[model samples]
Target chain A: MPLYLIGLGLTPDSISLKAINIIKNCSKVFLDAYTSILVSYEEMTKLMTEVLNRNDLIQADRTLVERDAGQILNPAKDSDVAFLVVGDALCATTHSDLYLRAVQEGIQVKVLHNASIINAVAGTGLEIYKFGRTISVPFFEEKWKPVSFITKTIENFQMGMHSLLLMDIKTKELDWKLYMRGIERYQNPRYMSCAVCCQQFVDVLNTDNDADLSVETKQDFEEIRIHAAKAGFSVDSKCVACMRVGTDDQKFIYCSIGEMAKLTEHMGAPLHSLVVLGNIVSDMEQEMLNLWKL
Target chain B: MPLYLIGLGLTPDSISLKAINIIKNCSKVFLDAYTSILVSYEEMTKLMTEVLNRNDLIQADRTLVERDAGQILNPAKDSDVAFLVVGDALCATTHSDLYLRAVQEGIQVKVLHNASIINAVAGTGLEIYKFGRTISVPFFEEKWKPVSFITKTIENFQMGMHSLLLMDIKTKELDWKLYMRGIERYQNPRYMSCAVCCQQFVDVLNTDNDADLSVETKQDFEEIRIHAAKAGFSVDSKCVACMRVGTDDQKFIYCSIGEMAKLTEHMGAPLHSLVVLGNIVSDMEQEMLNLWKL
Candidate 1:
């Protein structure tokens, strides 16, 4: 059986022509959806139906992917079956597990390369190479101390390398899941923002002085930039931010964390996580500097 | 002007019906290729050409993006325009840059959020919150020292965090304006492998012993499981070495990296990089541990 592993790059149009052909021809497709949400299920199902002319949108949530992954690979045991994930194939370990399953069954597997956030974030000119240990800041509980993220951030800071802080994902609606609306998303835990992010960060840092929270002027970091984004594909709408990054639109005007918090009101729709550009904002990243400056 | 920022996610079918509508209805379409290669030019051009019934593809490369991004944005300035990326709009910073640019021009920018590598890698059951900093492993250099990757790697190991190492893509076809395969790819200086990567990492560590390169044994890592995947949304022709990363395939079983190197001749194609499973490789993964003793 032939199994196809894929990586969904950044944008809907970011895929390679070769990948499209494979998916279009595949007999069965199993998507490991929990790793990351490349796009909405409604969009993916429709696209598949239109291209492959197939309506069978197989669903593999965290549970099914963990327990019944072997069953998903059965089609590949004889036919050209496909398993998909966001970013690259091996980018997620779950895909690796699926691969192991296929390998044990003596199935042939081929991986197609595509851009993932691992490199995509480099566009900010943050010197990705200089980034130190990456970590995630999970939503805190009053009882549990989720300080690992703080610990890592400090480690990177002490080494003078930037840190890549990944936020959290709370949901994964299936192919049959209904389309979510703006109001519905707002009702859900929205994507974190720079202003809210910084406040939460400083609050955490203040509690953990090991972070050397005093080193960076709270004023500079507190000057949060809000880049509010929508949840669906917007053809003509540009991504709106507190200030432009990576262009001559560099404006270093600082806004207070409290002032930045105003973004919650001003930001119209669903927001993604905030990229709190730390110690290494470059001169070329003009708008980032401007939005986070005095 | 409404600008649709479509995120292809990782799978070719991950796109939505709404996104297709935007692409088909838009006056002009540009695929932002740099930040992500969500879809290949040939495949998308063929399908989009047929599905959307567009006159032709905008086909913007790095140069156009850098020099004449304005042209791509022209449609968005006054009309409905669409630019697509691999995973999600904010997944890559370049798209954000585009947004900032349009905003400066008083153009309306909209972002369609899809799955991105940043959030997707968590599907592997490797706690999404446990990752450290992300680093890129550049294609080898004879004179230029790229030991930074080694250092970053060690730092992640120290924190017990897995590194999402992205290989450098110095594609000569795009840079030199030539597309030659075979030896041309060699000259192109492309993807990195586990072997070369190990060698470079070792070399980098040898420079500073105090930094401590020795963590878990290579056998332990390879034995645990290695995941090698390329990000691809449009192409299902991808492979992910999920199971038995550290063990042998069929008769060709070798215990250590040293042994694996010896068998490199018969080991089929050169391997892509490996995702050494740190957190998820449980004792259960030890079933493939037999290769470790050989």
Candidate 2:
């Protein structure tokens, strides 16, 4: 009885026959709901009980998976246990800790892979071969904004490699305040949109580097222009705003980085991703980009 | 009426429920066998005819797709047509040419994504976020050897980003010798192995750059060492050799570049990939690599 790590791809029907059969035979099935969610917990429940006709589904939240993994792994020692994940099992937020734990416990482990946005982003007609290191843009809070992803994007641009910026998703997260008060209230889910991501990039580009602090009139517009140029991208740099990729209602918008910031209210839905075009876009790539131009 | 591009993932059963249903209903179904193959034609025919209970399967080779794409797109104007590809529909080979052609002809196109080695390689426990631009290693001929991939791997190494080097596959390749003489024949399929890729990397490291031609004793080992150091990697650098990733028989071997090069005959079957580790590997990544270390 091996512990099966199964990937339920982007769409509900994207699950493979191998995964479905494994789910059916497993003594216990745990769906990792905290890292990401393909659909609502209710919808996934319906998929399992109604479609898969298996009622052994167990919802594993962040605390359950990260802090109390034994609830899922312990049973695998004697019975088949299935840990279901959205997208390819190991692509997005890694379950490596759990996998390592399983290995340490001498549990036979098997992984079933499926499609993930890491691969599905190719549907934008941008060749996967040219993509550089992927970046994750988290929702910026008032005091804790991070611009490392923006800088990395600039580096990718300088190297003539496209950047796939994966927007962050917050689901079933416990509010720190609530947790401190011994109340287990979960916060509303938040999914980062391309608008937010682009605005952050623009913000980073507008700011002067710490090294430039010694310069006189550091806040001057001309000074900022030189710094932005050094950063490798600008408000007018081309970017592709993707919404709900690998779904029927998928939408793509090709526009300047600054222009994308204005699409905050209309891009639609969760799971948005942004692509910063590198300097090496080929004629064919440019043609494909034109199909979604604003 | 629409032209559907469906991905049959790494394995035969990796097909999705949506794809199976779509294939069942499509008036004409085509398996793009030239770009890559998941299983033999006879096995796939059995999968479609016996498993799916449909007999509309058409084998679309390179000439049929690249040369006579109209054969697949024409019927899509009035009836449903499915073009099946091994791995994720767009990840490996860009079907953008065929897709753009469909759009030009005003044919509606729908793509169904599935798992491909692009995302599945994350099973190696190297965070997908740390991967740089992918490089493809082709079968080098005696007179047409290219070392551009080696240079790119070095660039990825310098950037502290892992490089996923995709091994080339030659499926249904035309025997150019026979084709020129009007003998329509395809040579046997060949899939690149990690052993060959590692050996090529070693060969590139052992050679001095063209600029060194002006210097006397350019072939000296000390001169090659200086160039290899400037190139950012050497025989002792770490790499992960992957065989048949995303499948049940998937195997991983983590070893030094020199040791990997020596594995010329034992890495096992087709669809192999190599990952050149970067300088920034985390402790968890190292632990995972230890699990498969040679």
Candidate 3:
């Protein structure tokens, strides 16, 4: 009995024939639900169950994944177990830990790779090789405000490479408790939108720096262009929009960063990513960005 | 009529159900063959053709792709057309250009994402977010030796980010002609092996540098540890090996660069990638790499 770490890809149809074949053979199926949410979780689960003809699909939240991985591993020792993850299995560090844990426990492991947002961001017309280290923007708190992402973005800019900023998602139960007790009662899981992310970027640029900034660096921060996209399940539904930050016309309009921050129109659903462009390397990228120019 | 840029993931089974369904409906199908080669191209094409019940699948070499893309796009204007690519559809900049072309022509286009070597490299135990810009090591010739990859790898190391070095493949027909007339008759396709890449790196460090090198920088080039892997179609068949270059005992042995350059063992088939570790960010990565430690 081996443990299979399978990637569900981006959409219900994105699942590979091999992945479905493995799921149909597994005795226990568990879906990891904390790192990132699938575009349509219910629809994906329904499609999986229907295709596999198995109703024993279980959802493994952060608690079960981080603290009680043994619950999945113990069963894998005697039965074929499948742990399905959104995007690619190795996209999240936690899933890689699980793969290592299974190997350490002497339970054979297999990983089925699929599309992850890491590579899918190429859909934004940016060259994948031109991307630098990726950063995540966590929800800011009154006491804990991280500007490391800003520093990383500046480094990427200096290196002539784009920076990919992943928006925060509240999926862990413990984090929910922390939010519910302090703020309004826990509403549905919160996804950081492009509007909020834009606001956060502006706030960081305006408040975080204490050193003397060069005139060019100041202008870079003020007029930096951002490419924001809600890459939905498929290409047909994806939305890619770009805007510069400090200009006038602040609204839902795709104009400046100030404007995009105040936007109320929804890009789509959850899982939004922002790309702060560095030096536009190719003619095609420049041309593509021009289409979204305000 | 719409053009679909579909990805054939890592393995034959990595093809998605949606891709198969769409291929069944597509009136024309062309496979791009120059950028990267699939693990088992013949096996995959056979499986896809049989499953889709179609035999009109055309292999689009670099000439056809770069010079006669209209052969695919023109037909796409009047019928459903699919351009199948290895790895993720847009991972290669050329495919992205083709996509832009389709859009500019006002022909509807859809991209079906799949696993790319970019994401699949995560299986090497290096965190995806920590990887910096990717570099390619082309086969060196008398007049066209390129050592820019070495410079970029050093930059990534200084920035504390890992570097993914894509080994060059001679899939272009023009290059085949250039090599065939000069050297021995061109053999089947050549995939840069870890031994050859390690040797190439050593050669670059030894002869190609003119800048002043600090002791630490010199040591960095001398003792850089690289993770090499032949990621096969199945997880069980995948091989991940690590070695430190410049150390003694290099005969096809998983050791240091100085040793690896002279080795003769074949590290399996083509399409191999190398990862020069910058700074291991997590204990898990260290632990995982330990398994492959020489």
Candidate 4:
């Protein structure tokens, strides 16, 4: 009896052959529903069910995964259990903990790695080697607003490296609560868009002065162009549309930070990421960025 | 006609169903041979050939890819061409350039992302968010020995962020040259082992003094522990044996830099990566590293 932490990749069609074979043979299959949302959950489920020729797929919510770990591991001890994740299994630290726990419990675990947003951001034409520590931008609350990510971004900028910002997704907790109350409440999942992230960035810059910067530093920050990429996993095209945002709207073809902050139009769909460019070293990189220029 | 850049993942079994399907339907399939090597090329080829029922697969060497990308793109003008990469397509900047070129030529392109070492290193129990810029450890040449990576690693250490040093792989260049000369040269491909990397690290530290620092910085560098991982893509187990190396043998369970420098043992296989730890942040990371302590 072994636990298989299989990566389902990005799209429905992105599932690997090895993953498919394992899922078909597994006694129980559980999809981790909390970490990050895939582009199309229904299509993924339909594809998995149809390919595996099995129903009764369980959706392991956050509470069940975080609280009741034994429920999954206990079953794994007796039979083959497939715990599927949207991206690569180890991308989220929680999954690594689960793997460690299973190992400690003497339950053999196998990880099937797949594409994650961490590496897929290379689709933006930005060199992956230039990327520094990645950060996540959560929906800010009035009482608990965090601007530490700004400092990290600044550090990366100083070192001539890009910073990838993962926007937040709020799904499972609300869904589980509604389900527990037996109410037919359908609250649409909230995905932080680039527009919202830009606004938040501006808000943090305006309020926070923890970094202790000069007026020139603030001016340099304003001039720095940011990239907003949507649906990086889309198979329709090899390249994803990355919008370059600067401070002056007239300087760039795309929207500036002020414009993006007040933008009403969405980039379309969930799972959008932002990239703050650092020092552009190579001519190729400069050429690629110029192509996206407004 | 369209071109599809497909990531083959870590192991032979890591190939996705979408990749297999696309390969089966592709008019011509070419494997990019130089960027990064998979676990076993023979095993991968066998698995892919058997699954696709095709044996006429071409190996796209570095020259064919970087210098003459037109050879691959020209075929896609009226047919579906599948260009396979070991990890993710965009992980290497060359593939990004290829995608850009294909787009410029009015050739529709699709990228099927897969697991890369960038995200897979999370399995080493090191926090991915705490990793800085990745560097490569190349075999030093007499006339041209570059120690710039050492500077980058030290920069990462200063920021309390880990550095992932990708070991170099030399395969196709020598093979192609030998073939062109009509000489039957059988040189086993060289993979930079952790032992060799450790020796090089010490050699660079002793000779290169680019980072002007005090004696305290040198002492701090000596105390930092490094992790060497091998067979990371093995499907038999989820965990990879990550050996922790410190300055003194008594400080850690694994070998010290001096010990590793003179070690004769090989870590096994072609693909291996080194992780030099930064400042340990959490109790979890400390506990995990302690497990590897002597």
Compare the candidates by DockQ and give the number of the best one.
Answer: 2
Return whichever of 1 and 4 wins on lDDT: 4
DockQ for candidate 3, please give it: 0.38
Question: What is the per-residue lDDT of model 4 for residues A85-154, given as tens digits with 9 covering 90 to 100?
Answer: 8777767653756776888999977777778878877665678888898888888764455656666766
Estimated TM-score for each candidate: 0.56, 0.91, 0.80, 0.78
Q: Tell me the tens digit of each residue's lDDT in model 2 across B39-144.
A: 5566667778866887667889988998999999999999999998989998877788998999999998898999988888889999999999999898866445
After superposition on all CA atoms, how large is the RMSD of candidate 3? 9.0
Among incorrect, acceptable, medium and high, the docking class of model 1 is incorrect
Each candidate's interface RMSD (Å, one decimal) is 7.3, 0.8, 4.6, 4.1
lDDT of 2 by residue, A21-107 (tens): 888878888888864466555766777886678666788988898899899889999999999888888887668899899999999
For model 3, fnat equals: 0.65
For candidate 1, give the lDDT: 0.50
lDDT of 1 at A163: 56
lDDT of 1 by residue, B130-163 (tens): 4566666776544354455545544555455655
CAPRI class assigned to model 2: high
Clash totals for all candidate models? 81, 0, 13, 6
Better of 2 and 4 by lDDT: 2
Each candidate's DockQ? 0.12, 0.80, 0.38, 0.40
What is the C-alpha lDDT profile of model 3 across A1-294, one tens digit per residue?
899877777776788888888888888888877643563457666787677766677888878987899999999999889988878778765466787788899998777778887887776667889989988888866545565676676677667788877887774334556566675354567888777876766664453562445555545444432211111111111123322111111111223455556664745455567776664457777665554544
Ranking by DockQ: 2, 4, 3, 1
lDDT of 4 at A280: 43
Q: Of models 2 and 3, which has the larger lDDT?
A: 2
